[model samples]
Target: MASGKHRDNIKQQSKAAAKKSGNSIASRISNSFRNHQQVAVDSLDRLLASISGTLMIWIMIAIAMALPLFLLLFLQNLQQFGSDLDEASQISVFMNTTTEMPRLEQLRDELLGRSEIQNVEIISAETALQEFQASSGFGDILSGLDENPLPPVLLVTPLAQDAAVLQPLLASLQDYPEVDEVQFDLDWLQRLYGILNLAQRLTYMIGLLLALGVALVVGNTIKLAIENRRDEIVVVKLVGGTDAYVSRPFLYTGLWYGAGGGLIACVLILLAQLILQGPVSRLAGLYEGEFALVGLGISGFFMVLLLSAMLGWFGAWLSVLRHLRAIEPG
Candidate 1:
């Protein structure tokens, strides 16, 4: 009976000890989180205390971030405009002046039936002459001609914009007896594509350089901050504070700077878009284009904020690791 009682007592003690251990672990985790939270809040308060200096840093970072962002937005809009032009691209097939209306209609139908062609629009000789007269502002001279000078034309929209496909199609059209000339102006289209590609490359290069600039700016700011708080860091270390504990506030400070800069950059970009909207609309109107300026939507906005915060954190981390090691309590 005594042996059984002793076994029961041992089991109860083990259960109690396990419970106490679990509670201790939970308490430690809670304390760690609370400490981090307090540190982060305190860091932000310090930044707020010197609003002028903080604002200056934020503006510098924002300008650096905004330059690349603006270039990217411009490139996106330009690409969209280029796509619009690409979709409207067509081959002009001028028929022989002697070609009859019936032959022109038949040729258009045949071109439309081809797998490579998406659409074919026929402009009768008389209609072409009238359009030319209206556009050229030489209506009197054109009307005095005994016979219509313009030939019937077919505007052929191809299914594919690839040069390989378009070149063959152009050659085939030229072989047709009714075709006086097949003009696709492939060179201009190719040049447009080349220009867009070059622009994209330039944007990427500029974005990379600007991103580096942002990181450097943050790092330099953090370095200055470390210098200002040199005595505080040395005191903390002397009191047996861990490196992480000493560095937590600075890390948070960097994060605040980056996040603030990101926010300011967003504002700048929006303002720029608004300022340019009217001019862009008017210009597009002049070109008979229905293009509208696009801004960083919700996803892009959040992404910028996140990226800026990351850069700030990285800069702070680098600064802390480099400078904290050199400071000794002795």
Candidate 2:
């Protein structure tokens, strides 16, 4: 009976030890989670504690971000306009005035055979002269002439409107023996495309500059916050707090600033789009176009918000890492 009792005590002790170990681990995990939650809460409190100051910084960041975002939206709309213009682009081929009717028919057939030409249309000299007379009010003066002075023309529509493709095709048509001239307003289209590309590059340059400005803004704000809490940081260090522990709250502070600024920037962009929509729509109508302004969709919105927060976090981390080393327990 004594031996049995001894075994019972040993088992009880073993069970108690297991339970205690389990409880210890669980408690540690709970505390770790709680500390993390506390850090976030404290960071939010810090932001709220100085509303006016935080807002000023946020507004600055928003303005910086909005400029680049607006430019990007404008470029996207321009690309749509370019696409519409591409569809309307056409090439005009004027035949030699004295070319035979059979050769003209042959030229038309050759153009139709090429894969690059989408459509071919013939404009005889008689039809052309009649059109000129009807519009120019020179009917009686032109009738006195023995024959029509105008040349037959071919209207060639290409499969592509891009200058590179059209240029080569136009050159090929000009090489035909029956062809007199090939004329296309490709220079105007090329110039428009060049301007659009320049604008896009400029927008990128501006965005990069403004992003740097945002980082500096956040960094300066974090530095001030750190300065304000210098004594608190020193005390924590003296009490055996790890560097990571001391920096966690400040890091959160930066994140709050970045996220808040990004949200404001998005609001500004949306408001701009809303206010300009009617005006833009009317302008498109004036040109007989169905153009509509496009805003950053779901993915884009979240990307802006998340990117802002990341920049803020990065700025804050940089500031903390730089300034914390200077702070030590005396």
**Which 10 consecutive residues of model 1 have the lowest summed lDDT?**
17-26
Clashing pairs in 1: none
Looking at candidate 1, what is the lDDT of residue 300? 92
For residues 242-306, what per-residue lDDT tens digits would candidate 2 score against the true structure?
Answer: 89899989888888888999999999999999999999999999999888888988788999999
Whole-model lDDT, model 2: 0.87
Residue 137: error of model 1 in Å? 15
Q: lDDT of all the models against the reference? A: 0.88, 0.87
The lDDT, on a scale of 0 to 1, for candidate 1 is 0.88
Sequence-dependent TM-score of model 1 = 0.69
Can you list the residue pairs that collide in candidate 2? none
In order of listing, the candidates' clash counts read 0, 0
